[model samples]
Target chain A: MTAALGQSARSVLACGEVRTCLLPSFQALDGRAAAQLLRLRADEHVRVSERPTMYALSPEVLTGVDCRLPTSNGSKVRAVGTVIARAALTEGRLLQSTAYFSAPAAGPDTRRPWGQYLVRPGLVEPFGKLPQQATVEGVLRGAGRGELDLGTIAEGLLTQLRRHALLDRRVPFKSRPTHLRWVARRQPEGERASLTNFTVAEGGLRTMELRLPEDVPAAAAAGLCEDLALHDWLLTTVQQMLDNSRIGAADGPSVVEALHPVVVHLLHLWMPRAHVDAALGHLWDVLEEKPGFSRQWEKLSRRIRDRLALQAVTMPHQAFSPR
Target chain B: MLIFAASDKGGTGRSVTSANLAYHRALAGDDVCYLDFDFGSPTAVAVFDVADAREAAEDRGLHAYLIGEVSEPERIDVWAKTEHQVLRDPPPGCGRLVLMPGDVSGGEFATTDDNLRRCVDLLMKLYHEFDLVIVDLSAGRSYAVDMALEATAQPEMSELTARWLVFHRWTRQHVAAAASLVFGRRGIVAGGVHRGHDEEALRGAIRFVRAAVPDPESPLWSQVSPTQSAWMRKTDGDLKQLASTAGIGYSQVLGSVPLEPVLQWREQLITDEDVLDSQIANQETWTALSRLAARLTDDKYWEEA
Candidate 1:
């Protein structure tokens, strides 16, 4: 069923948006709670994995849209189909939701029955020939007014999960959410998938472009982007915390108090490619080589540890001093 | 934390004062979202001076989002979009200030199930992303207030903290009407209880802001004759006594904004530039707004009286 719906369409373009943030619960959820939180449908079973890391993924849900496709040029193309959205929790601390859809090169000019669209999830059928380049640019740039908006769908899912009864609705620390918008253009079946461009813009926006083989499903691309977005959010949040800590200006105990959340919740979450499929795991190599994500994370981890150690050594003297 | 700003009358300075509170909170390094829930008359766009967003939000504002016309409402970044020369450049280390304007053509409508659900979803989303969410409601007993009460009563929102501030001018009629609006029959407390809110808890969460109050000791009023001065002091004392009898005494009052000519002439934020450089707005007004903003989340001020 997955192959029939996700791969048999010979999709020419794939686009998605991933929103990542810390789960708003004071305590991290266990596997049972994580699975319950990500249960998007009653009848469908949520996929839970615990091999390399604890992770739970919700079953795919569909949002139907019959609106103008975002185009870089002034051309207006109305598309009618369903967009797929799913939620995933990593280590019960970070929650992510992705809304994505794939499109074929062209489709029938008339609309089909909603039942027909429901049968094939995550496929948005354009009325006519899909302007592959314009749509790609448009998705990266973001949807315009009255356009197909994947961010809204993803945010809606996130909001739904955060309101689950199991959650305590309290977070240890406050941090902003990050949004990663990505588009993948299909190459020949024999070509290898490669990351083309990644730009980090202001206001927690990140855009990624990729070229993937035709045999690879769009769901895999979404998975790869989700992984990237999750790590990016971790780095961004920790960096913000450190910047706000005022280490040199503030006293030692206060700085330690500020960085305690990172040490407790985020340091152990840096296992890259832990949940990604092996075929798409190579995409992390480019990011690993130039501006090493793990390297920066390790340095940050060391700084936090050294501060804690120093504070421990000086505890006796500080305790003896006058308040 | 969610703060709902409601007023009993139209000229109570509810929208402008709440917008300023939102501004002050953002300047104090808390990411704040100001929602224009005054569906009948959406004037926050003009107050924030975001002319560009005024056009974009005409069709895709909170009204459209609540009515299912749009999936998401348009959010205008006040610091980036405000045409005010002083607000254009925010101080470093300050947090974000976002304004979710109302539709230009939006009007008051009865609450529906779908609308209530959408309102809950929007509030939950904002609560997660923002450190403080200030919702400016329409005046008097309106659909906006009803929706707010219904949405907060939902089980999903029970875990979040929601507070209300009823604004009124410093007049005997205004004070009496404000108290009745919250404590009278079919008032907020009664309506909240009907919607499944605990009466004591809802009453505890509600506070009042007395706007446009004239102080007899201020220089602006010192030019009056001795008879006028005595009469002013006597009226102020009588009003205070009347407020106490009306059940909205000194303890229930959050803060009061002095009568400033600038706030009367123009409904805009009282920035330091206005007080220091331009010399158009009063320093006392700025200080009062700052203190009120700080007290919005202060536990000491919000405890049961």
Candidate 2:
């Protein structure tokens, strides 16, 4: 899906994948260090915003792919262009890297020069006619072997940032990474963006479908998905911690130890739409209606607080007797 | 924890034993990733019973990754992809088991600065994601070992814990070679120290594993004549003294694996089925592997002598 720059004749679909994980560092980085850690490109600027939360975003890096686009109908459209990868640090604790590109409806039958595609940044022009619906489904299903893999590109960037000399390579907690795959179909101009579907698949994979207005940039849609993925990861990680601890089955001290990291690093970072574009922020309402992300987060956070309080109240006697 | 499995020579069962350690760790609820850094002969796929790894490695394997040919290596989830009958059905609460195979045709290459950086990045990422990251290096003082030493000695990996295991067989030459591989000139200790690793700390992290040991008292050897049995026992005692003198003494040894027909012949993982249903592998070998696997993470076993 090509970002609508008014130069591209028509943009059909935009797709992206966001990989979220805990930064492997014993102590959270400050704003300067976060920016230093995320400086992917030397020339481009690394955006650092601290109004709502401490967030540092790296300049985008490009990966070239000349492979067949995955299509549900098995249509053969060999796209050749660059996929954009960028790293984002939220509160210096949670880190996310996104790889996204937009594909136009159609292009010349033959291949173009690599330099021609480099100018477009995050656009992969398809060969011949493109079936938008089938391509969207194909992307969500994931690329076949030897196809353009956005997840791998994003993960590669994440791995690169994680190996920076600035990092200590020590994680405060053991938490699994989460991946969110998102696709947005272009709507008519002046139409409000809307959410189509949100699926929580097994194995830490989440799928998001949206009807984006034609004017919205692909980067903004990526931002919305990254925001959703970060909070979703927080909720999933905390819930898993609770489940693994066996709160009711296990004793008090163990439960408190399990939930400690949640309070330290995750609790205050739950501001949804903090970085999402205003036009696409409404899409979050659809997710809030059913399996409410914020509601569950609050419930889990409160449970942790109550347990900590209870332990504080009973610690004097229990500490003396346990020894 | 990152465990580097190395050996002074080939045919030491280093790859199979290390793969088994990774498998055992995953079975015990610790997420594990085993990387096949054996660039010359990438045979880890056979050990895990992943049939299509040769093809997959051709597409995008660890070789492609380290050499900058591919951005990311293809990781095969052992449980989902393995053709092994028992590993197909993952037991409840078992953690993830992943294998990062090397390119089938990836011959040995000298280490460059970029290659070293890539190696560090791969190990650091795996270290963050998995509870145990077992990297099976090629035998002797190869480029793979040099790259591993340089990668772990980097500043980014300073906070991470890394250990080394040198595998050798039960023979005079093997014992002497294993000792020299660690303490001799141009050995792991020397190489790591040359690459910024603390000499004492690196020494503490290195341990020796004696593979293919034979117990004369076992029933398999009971059929021998009295003189043969006596000779076998005396030889074993002499080998112990030789090993101690070589500097890989009792304290430095992590564990020993008894010689089993399965490991020697098939060169495959000796699963529980081999002991119970198949009856192809000896129970003593299984128990020894289990004990070695347990001692891998047990602090008491790793304490510096």
Candidate 3:
């Protein structure tokens, strides 16, 4: 990012290009460490969104951890602590555990892929962190022209958290985040909440927090028990938002809005018999749907067009030739 | 549509017909995949004059896939060998010819039927991604032939619709082999002819190379008569009756291309003109052949024909 920006004030993070990355999350990895990993993706010139914020995940999976005041999901069975790609890049670490995968892993060959991967293995569970906390030790490695967008990363991690049922609260079917909690920790607030982050301060009012509630359903809770692609999608959507915002276009909210129901439909499409085949059919049907349900998607897509207009993006011409 | 081209014997015009038909289909703007499956000698690759396609075969050449090397099956390359051909270039949308060249270096067949089936599976995948798949099978029945036929018979084999075409000269022996290889019940050789050798010419090799050697006036033609004529009559009778039994008939038999040496030389790199004048105009021999190629793609023309 520093090299590509080359003293150009336009960007020192991303060199001003629209990059489509299918990022993976990790467990036992810190947010700073994940940021470090992001910086290593120097192949594409990325333009950082001005005043972007970090979004970290510490989604608490119901487990053996103790609470000062007894929590609502009961005393607990065993807490699954995890830190994935989003958590590692956002708040510096994750609070809970989930099956997180990483990218371009320089670690032991865990059969991880390099780019836009569907499944790339990383730490199995908690990178050893707690909620509302940042990791100073064992952290990720990445730095841009400025601080990374952890909020978008955190949002993306929410998808993994939701998919892996890493959250402490029960989610309803067809549930979408009606509101986002932007609590900034260690930093002052920015231009707008579109680049929202949980603002955690030492002795200040703006600190990151989660909304835990009583009367949350068991099936919704049980949904947290199963691994779902929708959860992955949720995090991916956030990453898309963060990436776009970094280049001065944040599409997080609308994509979240459009995809939430689609996610639900996708979840329900899975059946015991021919589960994969049936689910794909539903997915194709919805993906190929012309004149999409809402104009919000079109509005965002147009913004993507404008963003794409910002630069000369290229894939190796050799990649298209048959090997 | 997938055109599985095969012949009972070596001298049969299988490759010639296959190349011409593929040329026409490709010319019509259909993305075509031409796979040379003659694993033994791989005559189609040489005939298509794409034998040198080996230069581009580090990718998934047909041979490489058979040997478990490449993952992606590439298209046939229209090599520069056919520089002297009639057509300057093949048909238009006429992207690069993805020639899945044969295993020239190996000189061996697929290890097993399963491996040959894998080759067909790869071809079918190409068909799904492309508009047509043309498989040039070996001269005689081989595992490649069985897999190709089985692929066509099985509905779930591929998204590509299929038509089985048997190429043969208008000679008695060629026709006999063609009829028996596919007509009989057990697999394709239901009523098809068994292996037999042509008699040594006491006089000399017949020079009317374009025409069937057994001239009616020749005494060798007489010596060939009674049995072959009886067999031809029986083949006609059995095919008529067996069509009902096997639930398929001679109508499904696409057509036969003539044995024309001049036309056969540039068989693989079929020019638009080569097929236009010869593959279609040779009425006595290739009469039904051009019509067959025409119907393979255009469903409306098929309705009209």
Better structure of 1 and 2 per TM-score: 1
lDDT agreement with native, every candidate: 0.89, 0.87, 0.38
Encode model 3's per-residue lDDT on B118-159: one tens digit a residue: 554565445533557777888666767765655443333423
Better of 1 and 3 by DockQ: 1
Best-fitting candidate, scored by DockQ = 1
- In candidate 1, stretches whose alpha carbon ends up further than 4 angstroms from where it belongs are A1-8, A42-44, A112-120, A245-256, A302-323
Candidate 1 chain B has its poorest 10 consecutive residues by lDDT at: B51-60
Error of 2 at A307 (Å): 6.5
Candidate 2: Cα lDDT at A246: 48
lDDT of 1 at B117: 89
Cα-based TM-score, every candidate? 0.93, 0.88, 0.41
lDDT of 2 by residue, B13-40 (tens): 9999998888887877778899999998
- Model 2: CA > 4 A from native: A1-7, A39-47, A59-83, A108-121, A141-149, A200-204, A242-255, A295-323, B52-58, B276-280
Those runs of model 3 whose alpha carbons end farther than 4 Å from true positions after fitting are A1-323, B58-60, B77-88, B91-97, B107-117, B152-155, B158-160, B185-253, B266-290, B297-305
Best by lDDT: 1
Q: What is the TM-score of chain A in candidate 1?
A: 0.94
- When 1 and 2 are scored with lDDT, the better candidate is 1
10 residues in a row with least lDDT, candidate 1 chain A: A243-252
The model with the greater TM-score, 2 or 3, is 2
